[model samples]
Target: MKKVINNPENVVNEMVEGFIAAFGNDYKKVHHTNGVVIKNKPNRVAVVTGGGSGHEPLFIGMVGEGLADGAAIGNVFAAPTPNTVLEVTKELDSGQGVLYVYGNYSGDVLNFDMAAELAELEDITTKTVLVNDDVASATKEHAFDRRGIAGDIFAIKIAGAAANDNLTLEEVARITQKAANHTRSIGVALSPSSIPSTGKYTFEIADDEIELGMGIHGEPGVKRTKLQTADELTANMLDYIFDDIELQENDEVCVLVNGLGSTTLMELFIVNRKVVEILNEKGISIYDTDVNSYCTTLEMAGVSITLMKLDDELKNYYDKPAYSPYYFKKGRG
Candidate 1:
């Protein structure tokens, strides 16, 4: 195993420290905890989302004025401890209450559930909405029960906008779940990623091969085949997404063409162009589009396409203002 690090156990702690050091003014670390909360606590609903590391700009980068109120950091590919989540809840909670939004991963489910229980004992109101938007991960018979992926960004963004509008915790959670249900995602990986601690590729594929339906953690994909051109790849990804969701003409949709990690913006743009062309051919209008690296797999080379079938309400929230380290939007109103 080849990696650059002092110790495997300290990787998470070190990464968290660096993150706080760089963004500490905008955020403050919870004393003796692996959590971060916004420096200025808004009196409206509080949003906290988190999970394992390696997927930076996710639970952490979303912490800002118009996004997550706090984030609980966990080890690479592992969930944060329940106590860590509780600390984050304590820091972000104003009198209004808190909403925990995160991916539908087993470790996250167990730990966040325990944290909610602990927070309730302190009289802190808490609710959770899991993101399960990877249509390629599982079929319709198991959509609600499948794993969450890059589509989580849409959930967090819409929910944060709801909270920014002073929606109740229940309302925020409801809207977040709605976004998750309405959204779907699919990804293809040209390469694998290495966990900092392990110093080995999480999964492997031949040089000319690609993995479809690949998870962020480098889990084995649904299928492996020779690589294709940008247009062909986009079609391969969208075919499953559009077929499964059955979007209709005139449907206003939000599209996210996300780079996993090492993939460049130039490549993403080429892929985005094809995606837009295909969607336009179907007469489906795009309400909003985000083509960037919103989610990642720690230096992995690949991209994921996410589609959110939006309604007027969702489009309104999505158009609202947002500012974060990795994302920014001017208020449309």
Candidate 2:
């Protein structure tokens, strides 16, 4: 219920404005659009990914040097309009094809598909890779039915690197899908995030409790229990993720500890400490690691851990240099 703003309805607009104001040197707003961000420098295969607005540094903060070339921002926790996606797609097309990558949500899927169809009519080829790495969202038998969450960063990074490598549109999309398939993520929410307009949390949780496997939008979790220690929570999260993707000894993986919104770096590192401890115990090699709030849910107090089991191809792309407003990695250390 507490927010700093002029009008609730104008939050998205002002957010876009503020983003452009600060990052105009690297990003430009699409003319006559609600929420479309285009990179100043074009890529061989334009990478586009977006979703609702509340998840900062996601659909927008990701548009830069080594990430998505463009992003179509949607309303808070809502899908961007088809027209918005179409416009960004069109602007991104520089003879090379465009790749649309976003989370797996009903509204997002529908709108992005529509935009792709519209772009095809103009001879602007487009491909899509829907991210569904939230292992807790579905059983292995229905993995594709799961919702996308922090795993999106892996998708975008691999796709953008492929595109930057001058790979063909189909190649970029293929590798991006491959990276997505190797990824798994799960989260725990200590508190709920509210919609600015409504000034209400989407769901309620007790002050001394947490929801395990909760989705970013306050979706029902596997269980709601009293708050546990950081190590306990991390172990529970890793267990859920490992149930879906087995990490064999000597298998190399990328570990990402993502803060939702209000979760601090100190907390994320604590989670990462446990993640590393568990991985080392299993003999899983850590190739690269990142701990930050690459994606967030509007001040939600939570963290999500993502693991991308890497093959040679995926590791190459994962180690590629990337520079975004919110994400920066100089290859792998």
Candidate 3:
């Protein structure tokens, strides 16, 4: 329960305020809501994303120049309200349509779909692409039933870039959908993240054990076993990803080695090192590799590896300049 704050109930609000204070020049709040939008939106199709708040640099950090146009923020590990999502849509919707991108969580799906319906009443044409990239969540036959994790960044980046190119909403949505379909991710948790409001860890694991393929909120993983070395663990996680995606030799990919909060860069790089070695051995070319804490559960000690199988079409958009307080993978010069 050791955290710096005024009140537990006010953590989301306070965090939002602090984020604004630090990044107000590029973003602004939707009227009376947790929805955050770029201060000056473009005339192209808008890409909006959202989810629970604890995963900082996620729903919020994804907004910027070549990223999401707006982000509807929910409470910690909670989905954004329909009203909050609608507000963000209202702000981002130009003459062009809007595309909604978010993780494939039940609460998030419910709220975002409601928001889309509400937006439709306002004559804002909208499309949705759910990021269901967590390979360990479901079998390959049930890929669409899986959860979204670090793979969300791939969808956001491709979609945001296509939108910035002033492509039609349909085209942008298509590109985003392609990215979501091509992405696969898997994670292992060494420790659980603490809930800010309750000051309790969301889940528990023995100190000598790790949960393979655990979801960010500590949803049950595929297995729990004694902790292994970084190389072994990385390969174990990748086994699931490779099984999910039929990666072939000479295929190109964008790899994301994401850290869930407390994991250090040093450890993350070690994991990434193993990832590179594996991909190289498989003869799969890497378009780019980003090893960072782009998505996280608060101070959760674990890392998730995401692979976005790329086609030339997807790569064109992915390489576009994007920027926010976080995520400089394809940032502007």
The per-prediction tally of clashing pairs is 0, 0, 0
lDDT for 143 in candidate 3 is 83
Ranking by lDDT: 3, 2, 1
Tell me, what's the RMSD of every candidate?
1.4, 1.2, 1.3
Please, what are the lDDT tens digits per residue for candidate 3 over residues 62-96?
A: 99988999999899999999999998998888879
lDDT string for model 2 (113-148, tens) is 999999999999999999999988888999989999
Backbone steric clashes in candidate 1, count = 0
Q: For model 1, what is the error of residue 173's alpha carbon versus the real structure, in angstroms, after optimal superposition?
A: 1.3
Return whichever of 2 and 3 wins on lDDT: 3
Q: What TM-scores do the predictions have?
A: 0.97, 0.98, 0.98
Q: In model 2, how many backbone clashes occur?
A: 0
Ten residues in a row with the worst lDDT in model 1?
A: 1-10
- Candidate 3 RMSD to the real structure: 1.3
Tens-digit lDDT string for candidate 1 (1-333): 456677888987877788889988788888888788889878888999999988887878888867888889788878989999999998888878899888888899999999999999999999998998777677789886777888889988998899999998888888888888899999889988888766788887899999998989887678898999999999989998987887999998999999998899999999999999999999999988899988898889999999999987888888899988887878685
Q: Please list all clashing residue pairs in model 1, or write none if there are none.
A: none
Best by lDDT: 3
If candidate 1 were superposed on the true structure by all CA atoms, what would the RMSD be?
1.4
Candidate 2: pairs in clash? none
Off by over 4 Å in 3: 330-333
